[model samples]
Target chain A: MSQQLAVGIDIGGTNTVFGIVDRRGNILYDGKMSTKAHGDITSFLNELKERLDVLIDKVGGKDNIRGIGVGAPNGNYYTGTIDYAPNLRWRGIIPLANLLQDYFDVPAVLTNDANAAAIGEMTYGAARGMKDFITITLGTGVGSGIVANGQLIYGHDGFAGELGHCIVIPGGRVHAGTGMRGSLESYASATGVMLTALEFMDSRPEQDSMLRHTPRELVDSKVIFEAAKQGDPLAIEVYEYTGMVLGAALANFVMFSSPEAIVLFGGLTKAGDMIMRPVRHHMEINLLPIFQNKVKLVFSELKESDAAILGASALAWEMKTDQKAETPQP
Target chain B: MSQQLAVGIDIGGTNTVFGIVDRRGNILYDGKMSTKAHGDITSFLNELKERLDVLIDKVGGKDNIRGIGVGAPNGNYYTGTIDYAPNLRWRGIIPLANLLQDYFDVPAVLTNDANAAAIGEMTYGAARGMKDFITITLGTGVGSGIVANGQLIYGHDGFAGELGHCIVIPGGRVHAGTGMRGSLESYASATGVMLTALEFMDSRPEQDSMLRHTPRELVDSKVIFEAAKQGDPLAIEVYEYTGMVLGAALANFVMFSSPEAIVLFGGLTKAGDMIMRPVRHHMEINLLPIFQNKVKLVFSELKESDAAILGASALAWEMKTDQKAETPQP
Candidate 1:
């Protein structure tokens, strides 16, 4: 099975996605299953193993299966485990890859989904040739993958590149996960976008904005984008405000990584220019003269739905390549 | 004069300072001269060169010198030039290292002052053992120096670490230099801090704050710090607001470099915990749970006056060490 094929798996709080991917970023086979209903991680692994076995059979009897790569919410590359992940109600260190490898008798590796996305972008998405860049997902929550010097920074404990949490405003707003006020996520996530629109509605109750017509809980970004597309003022401001916060956060990242570009990916970002224009405007207005025209903001080419899986798969390939390169192969 | 001691020159907008430094980060001798009150930069270089010869002879004489490291406002390491610098009234690139090297009969290297500070931190200051960290200075303007994967990122045009220009707010308020709006500098730099104080003052004209005693044009951070120390609510809020902005920017940086720490230097940082506490609180509030309790936001150990000289000397020492390390032995 050496150098034959690798399984790329991206595990989330709600769903588990695994794909048989080759060295060239091609998906040979794939499957989806729910990540254990409770904290029963072992059960989740067992289910994954069963599904992988089926995929192996579908791909001609598993003769070419070499290893597996897993991208999880809180996977730690250095420790070869996942720490307390709030989403899955998991605590302590879970030797996820090792446990799964025991069942399949093959090499297994893992990394955080953010780092995986970074590797995916480097290998196949918007930042393909750039040495430095950041990829952000404005999904249920915001996710950031930072790439510097053409390599993902795992930091001292493989817990680096947490871009979504940085506060854009201190004492200015509130976020669900963090107790602090004015985090970038507070202003720019899917929920954050709605909050912004909701706050705008609250501020101008007398104004005849379309958001006033929408219920608070029923209010979502898709509806907001639809309104913006149809010339809704408040809807447009939400995207602009999101872009402003995102742009500010990104400018700070640009300072640190000096990335040539930043790729935006996520469900909220499907609005495209409605989002990018404000982010760019703020970035331009905020950047110093030297970085004025040097960096660019781009959209990820990978499908928003499949990007996580592709990114996770890329991480596995990258880890294997690094190990092979450094192991003094005979 | 072939082996005369290497010169470490620190050039600024107002004055030019040069010193003969050895490979050990020690300044053997030094002197300064006015950098021409009016037009042209050649006069400054010629005067600097003449003074350097005098200092060099008084120390170890000409043969002891080997090279020169020029730290300037817009010096470029790769090109060995100083491009246009707005503060210096210079508007074109000059082969500064070449011009000095030929004159001193020694190799001359060049880099921006902030970069020199970063290298200085790497060689002789707080960041000596670290490979990833960011250094921010709150001075006339916000400036940053970045070290990634143990090497400084000069970026595409040696402009990679420009943190001052990234917009923190887009079209919300405050103008920034980089054609953007609401940059970190708009609310964090010394000037930025004062701007906030001024705005705060406008809404509280009758307050008996110590800040009211100081004239507007003559106002500086020292006055604000003194007022805060004297229990001035306005001054205290100014400091808090400044920290809020800085914390947000640092959080932004956390997402990108994921540095172990961010070191703050310069005058305004004299506020100490008044600034650090809020920034830490804000940063914590904004960071993702995975990145929590990991990143350190601390102060720089280097003094403002001695920092430039020490950093410049350290920069030379670094170049000397690397060049010596790379040279073929007999």
Candidate 2:
């Protein structure tokens, strides 16, 4: 059988999603499993290989598969390892690409999920035909991928483009994950919205709202979005604040690279105009006259998981045939 | 005579400097002229042409010259024009490259001064042999040039790498030039140092210092440096604060591109360890663990004007022979 499909894996904090995709961005087969269920990297690898084998057989066996690509938090493109990923059960460096390639008998590649999303955007999404753009993922954690001169800025360490970690507040909110003070991720992510919602409702006890009744643990970006839809002023303020910080950060990014557009992705983007209006307004006001009003700000058309899967899959197309047999072990 | 020399011009607000340079980076002949000595740009061009002709003749005529390269405020590499340079006598867009090429009958290239410094550093200074690094000029104003994958990131509008304008403090300080709040330039440039020194001394009226004795008009970064060297606590605090903000901004730039080193240029760097200590401290504290302590922060080895001249000259090497005749008029 001709090699016509690539396996794409998106490793998330809670769940691991994988798909077999063709060249045209079609997901021929896909499935999900608990990322932490197996506890150890070895057990997780065993289960992944077992599950993937069944999908491989269904898709006319291994010969029909082109290669594999994995997108994980803290993934390093140059080393093909996941280094010190905060959310992962396994600590330190894991040579995931080597393991996956050895198990599947095909070439494998890995990159931080945001970088994968950027490539996916360039190849199949909003950034198509554009040589310069940025993809910002606003989810549980903010992630970013910067593309300039038609290539991802992997930097010297393959860890460039961490816009989420860039300080926006300057000694303001403390980030729980990285212990970073006033990072864009700390203020603009879904978790940030929840934190903001809780603080706003708690501080303004007299400002009666539906969110005031919701348990603090149960309150998330979705609850805030729902209340916001119902014209909750406090909730609306949360989106505005989030967009303000995000917009300021976006302006900073704009000055750094002056990309043609900034593609926003993930959960918080669902807030839509509630977030974008302020983002656009702040970004414009902060920019120099030469850079004002030129960048296109758009939403990612691909579903969150699908975009990650497709983006990871896009990497496999670059694998050379000789890459399959050469392995760099951890 | 062989075409082994390039004419380099550094256009500044007060004075314009030009040099006839050999391929190995030696300035064979150099001269300076008052940029505003001529009221209009047309007169300035005529004077510049007449002066350059003498230098060209000294170097065996125009036939020996490879091309011309210019570094100026608001220079656009793509359009070869100076667009709305606030400091320059000429306003709006001036097609300097086209005019120079037409006069000298050779190709002419232009980029912002900071970018020229970057190319110069890469070719003949501290950044030599490094593929990825940033050159930051902290002069009367802050300017930057970013190099990644061995190419300057000009962005979509030929105006990328404006690290100076990136908001580091987020509404903390108002920039005089652009009126933007809390920009890196507002807090880190030489002008910023003067402002900080004044604020520091005024905020503590009881504190007796050398700066208090100097007239406010005469007090500048040099005065502050002298005061700082004398162990004046208030002046030292000003540098500490400047370094703190500059370091935080540097951390942001590091996270953006992950360059191997950040080369510091211009007047403020002359303060040496007085500023570098706090900059390194604040930058390390602000960065995530993965990025901490990896980037080398060093001062530019080239003299201020020479670096700009050499950097502008470097652009001439890239001009294709055929590029000389095809002029794009502004």
Candidate 3:
């Protein structure tokens, strides 16, 4: 018998990364496609199916492929639909999982990208042995996937883990898209860091900083992190403020679920101790005494490039287990 | 065969209520003892056992009793202990459950009062058929119990559902006991409502209301509720502000767990529509569009007097089921 494998696909706004992964979480083969190039869902699936077929053949044909798991924006696990993902061209609910299953003649599952990251962490990263923990992905927008009692919390609507949108500062910073003020996403995301940097620079007229030299449009989380590393006071302040907000929000998350650990993933974590110190400080300061020193805040151990694919593939393996449970053998 | 029964105990600061409950949740007989009357745990237990034996004899006796369940402040379910309950006379961790088991020679379990209420709601009240819901007890202090996927969330440490401590208004009201500022318990509890009314009165010296006539020390949640009934502007404003804070916290809770419903119990909820209207309105206003108007904020249907006993009895039933699972007969 051939070694069983699963296909993992991570659908992003700009690009989609897909890979054939073994049971041990190794990506045997990987591929990418331009997400924006295909205007419709059908075209996107056609391109994906065509590319995946070649990869499947290389890995000993379709029989060896156990299933396909997809991680997409606003993905709903229960319905297997992607609903109104702002970054994606798709306007409404798209049955991407069903489409993939039909095209490949294999079972397919889908979940939000953040949830996929959480599953990835559980399967092979920071949350490997933990039954209760939250995975926070601080990227273009903040996203979260909560795991409790060794199971991902899908909730009643299968959209339980939207921690980013939880308002950290009521009536404070207005979110660009949601228009909701003081949301964690509005203050802690990569975009949020840039916005905070811009605001800080604008407030201080006499302070000389590397960020001030760059054009407003060119300034991003990367530039701000670089400026902080070079000891720019304004850049340092930006991270401090961002971490404070993120920490307070994390404390709230801790109080809610009482997770054993909270794993931080994505771009913001790249700042290392610069961002982590304040987050740790404020989180402890805000937490109740019972929870104060109990929760471990750690970064994702999964390789960033492989995390999404691994997470999606973990979902595929999960489906195989579910199928086995449902069908008993004599 | 005699119908199996369980002894349910609700241990409060001033008084302790105990009853023999059947499988269908009916309290066959009930009695109370003054908790503060006894200075030591042994004395308290002796008195409680002496009184309870008479009640047990009225029924079918000890053979008919399946188990015992106790609900108290700061109760730890895993260890069956009550740790440093500020309101109670007990100084340190009291192994109340183990003590009961030793005394009665039957199985006994323990949990926090709020968790008991949640179990009660699930077993005999509003949350009877609901798999995902939160029970918020707004008494002297705020407390909560969360149920997800048809089980109470005890988290990694068996103390997961501590929603009262979650900060709603950062740096807002300071909790008298926890010393934590801006906690949900500080703003949404009955005591919080009294404090809010008192603060409002102090701020607006020019405003005339029925509360002005009542001595400052005399004002309580019941007094404020009576004043709100008469449509006093100051009293009414107090409920509105309390509701606003509660609503915002409820919105955050909804975002965190996405429970199907949030059941409100205890004294503060008795303000009825005066509190519920603003809570529902603000909860919707603060929630993201997807979660807006989806969560049901309902008052618990269990009789306030019977809820604690019923909840504890449910724990006894749960223990019985667990025992059966552990020891399967051939």
Candidate 4:
């Protein structure tokens, strides 16, 4: 019998990446396309289908394929819809999973990218065998997935884990996407880091920093990381402030769920100890005595380049397992 | 066979209430004793057993009893221990459930008072047939119990749902117990309300208020409630401020679990719309657009006088159901 495969699709603002993965976490075949180029959902679906057909044929068509799993912004697992993703061009709710399932002639599942990352971590990364842990994706914006008793907390609605939006510095900084002040995403994400660097440089006129010389458009998380690594005091302080905010938020999460560990992922993690050090410090300091020094804070073990596709793929595998449990054996 | 009954015990700082209850929420027999009068655990246990035996006899004794359930401060559900409860005379972890089981020759289950309250609400109160909800107990101190997907979030360490300790204002107010600053409990409890009233009076020395005429010792939640009802501006502002802080914290929690409802219980709920109006207003304002009006924030339906005992009793029923699942019938 041919080996069963699942298709994983990761929809980002700029690009979309899809991969055909086997049950064992191997990416057998992969492709990419421009998300912004397809102005409408129909055009995006058609382009995705046309590109995926060649890969599906190579892997013995739809019969050998188990299902498709999609990781998208503001994705809803229960309804399998993308409900008004701020970063995406799609307005209102799009029945993306239904569209995918119909086009592929197979079942498809969908959840927010962070949730997908959490499942990926549980299946094949740092959170392996840890029943209660949280996966945080610190990218352009912060996203999170909370797991308790080995099941993702989907809550009453499908949008349970929105840690980024949890008000940390109540009435502090306004987010461009949410318009809410003092959210974790305002200071913890890559964009937040850049904003902090600019704010610090502006606030302290006499502070000598490499960031001051760099063009505003050119400065990003990577540049800040490099500057911090080179011992720029201003760049280092930016991470210290960011980590402090992130850590305090994490401490609140710890008290809420008492997870065994909190796994960090995405672009902001590249700062390594620069962010991790203060995050560890502030998180422990803010925690109640019982929860202090207990939760393991670590980075994702999955290769960042492939983590998205793998995370999305893990959902398909889970869906297949659920289906088997529902259907009685002959 | 005689109808099955369970024993429920609620251990408070001042008093310990115990009752025999049937599955249908009927209080068959009940009694109370001074929790502090018995200075030690052994003495407390002996007095408790002696008082409970008479109630058991009235209900046909041992054979008819299903099990025992207990609710107390610092209670650990998994270990059946009460670890270092500040209010109680007990200094360290007390194996209350194991002791009860040995003395009564029946199973005994234990959880924190708030968790027990949540179970009670689900079993026989306003949260009946609801799968997702949170119960916030606003007594001397704030306490919370979180239920998601029909199960309490025990977390990895059986210490989940400590929403009271979740920081609302970073470095804002100091908690007498945990010494943590800006925790929800520090601002949302009955004690918090009293503290707010005192602070308001102190800050506005010339402001005409009835509270100024009343002695400091006479000030409490009930007094504040009465003052607010009588249209005292200072007292009314106290509720508004407390509710604003609480409402913001509730919004953070709503973002975490997206619970269908948030049930308020204990002393503070007596203030009614005085507190509820600001809480509803601030909670809605802080929430992201998707989560704004979806959650139903209501008062718990359980009668406060019998709630403690009823909540503990509900745990016994749940324990029996769990045991039945584990051990198959002939």
The candidate scoring highest on lDDT is: 4
Better of 1 and 2 by TM-score: 2
Off by over 4 Å in 3: A1-3, A320-330, B1-3, B320-330
Model 3 agreement with the true structure over B159-217: per-residue lDDT tens digits: 77888888878888899988988998898988899999999998999999999989989
TM-score of each: 0.83, 0.94, 0.95, 0.95
For candidate 3, what is the TM-score? Answer: 0.95
Better of 3 and 4 by DockQ: 4
How do the residues A169-235 of candidate 4 rate in per-residue lDDT, one tens digit apiece?
9889899987999999999998899999989988999989999789988888889999999999999
Superposed by TM-score, candidate 4 places the C-alpha of residue B9 at a distance from the truth, in angstroms, of 1.5
Error of 2 at B190 (Å): 1.7
Clashing pairs in 3: none
Candidate 2 displacement at residue A257 in angstroms: 0.8
Which residue pairs of candidate 2 clash? none
Better of 2 and 3 by lDDT: 2
Cα deviation in Å at residue B291, candidate 4? 0.3
- Measured against the true two-chain complex, the DockQ scores of the candidates, in the order shown, are 0.39, 0.78, 0.70, 0.77
Question: Can you write out model 4's per-residue Cα lDDT over B1-330, one digit (the tens) per residue?
Answer: 353898899999999999999887889899999999988999999999999999988988787888888999988887888999989998998988888977887788888999999999998898998878899999988888988878888777778888889899998989988899999998899889988999999999999888887898888878888888999999999999999999999999988888889999989999899999999999999999989889999999988989999999888887853452113111
Deviation in angstroms for B152 in model 4? 0.3
List where candidate 4 sits over 4 angstroms from the true fold.
Answer: A1-4, A320-330, B1-3, B320-330
